[model samples]
Target: MNLPKKAEDAHAALAAAFNTGDVNTVMSMYDVSGFIVPEPGKPVSGAEKFEEAIKGILSIKGKMEIKTVYCLQTGDIAVGRSEWSITDGDEVKVSAKGIEVMIQQNDGSWKILIDHAFGAEASLVA
Candidate 1:
């Protein structure tokens, strides 16, 4: 299906918010009952809870860059993959892969059902 622009925009905004370390913005991307798969170091479930879980990483000096937004919609359910990288100052902290599952609400807005982030490994920049 050709997913609506609003849905695509929302996902894009989510990526921006997440990369910028904006707690409120990031939290805004989820539904009340929405869930997250939790990167290896993060906790699962609840928007605020997941926000708190990522604080540690956000605390460390870094900038997040997201790439490859792959989305597919089946009825009202949408799933996407977000590939990301973290740069700590001039060094690359990590390069990760993530996936999101979203549900379209009756209001025609979208909410995330799952947000999972993880990496294959951590490598130091040469």
Candidate 2:
């Protein structure tokens, strides 16, 4: 997997890898300590778990489109938000606005530390 040179490019890297349906490449974009919120309340960690979560999405067999909404960085850490969607031809498979926390590695490539897939959604009244 090719890591993004800038934090702003993380979403694009992920979208490209996801569009290719390569779980390993997608997983490679994450840091060893990273975790992902595949569901609003469920955070999955570990390579095996992350890979499983990614596999489920890949099964949708849609193309991923992600646009960076915002990104703030200081030192080696960055936080970003993005609006994303998956489409299979004319049908929308998934759509969401999310947040991601990333860290710049020693090599100056950014890796995802936390990916909250639904973080930008409006909270329900409970």
Per-candidate Cα lDDT values, in order, are: 0.65, 0.89
Tens digits of lDDT, candidate 1, 1-126: 122245555556665666777666667677747656555654377656777755655665677776646778888888777777778777988667776678887778777777666522344121
TM-scores, each model vs. reference: 0.71, 0.94
For model 2, the local distance difference test gives: 0.89
lDDT of 2 by residue, 36-67 (tens): 98877888998888998889888987889999
Off by over 4 Å in 1: 1-5, 41-43, 119-126
Give candidate 1's root-mean-square deviation (CA, Å). 5.9
Model 1, position 121: C-alpha lDDT score: 30
Q: Which number leads on TM-score?
A: 2
Q: Model 2 Cα displacement at 38 (Å)?
A: 0.9
Worst 10 residues of 2 by lDDT: 117-126
Model 2 clashing residue pairs (backbone): none
